[model samples]
Target: GAGVSQTPSNKVTEKGKYVELRCDPISGHTALYWYRQSLGQGPEFLIYFQGTGAADDSGLPNDRFFAVRPEGSVSTLKIQRTERGDSAVYLCASSSRGWRTDTQYFGPGTRLTVL
Candidate 1:
């Protein structure tokens, strides 16, 4: 069985460009999360999905960042008008249950570079 995985392990784009980052969680996991890790900082929570709907998205920085778990399996993180400050490693995680105590398995992460 495959673990959590993200596409386009490295992405480079100009400022103000639109980008879509994809994540595929482990099969049968009900909890999914998206995080962003900036230089010298730990991964910061971006969004969480319990099923097909977003359970919490308070961590998203602004309107430019959005994520979706349409089928409760695969998710996509869409960024509009990307900025240089958006350059960071995007991470995805999954767990069997969406509880505070559940152990999360993380993906390798997608490194996004905005020029």
Candidate 2:
């Protein structure tokens, strides 16, 4: 089975531009998550999706950030009106079941640079 994967390993965009980062989870995984990691810090939870609905999105910074897992497998993180502060390494992870103790497999992450 394939591991989690993220597309556009690196992204550079000017402030106010719109960008979409993608993630593909492991086959048969039913839970997906999106996180952001800034310099010198651990990954911060952004959103979590169980199946096609977002189970928890309280970690999203603001309305500018949104994510979806329509098919319960692939997900896309969309950023609107990007800001320099939004620059970070966007990580994606998935697990077989959405449990507090379930092991999550992480992707390499998409490094986003907002200029």
Model 1 segments more than 4 A misplaced: none
lDDT of 2 by residue, 1-115 (tens): 6799999999999999999999999998899999999999999999999999999999999999999888888999999999999999999999999888999999999999999
Error of 2 at 54 (Å): 0.1
**Lowest summed lDDT over 10 consecutive residues: which window, candidate 2?**
64-73
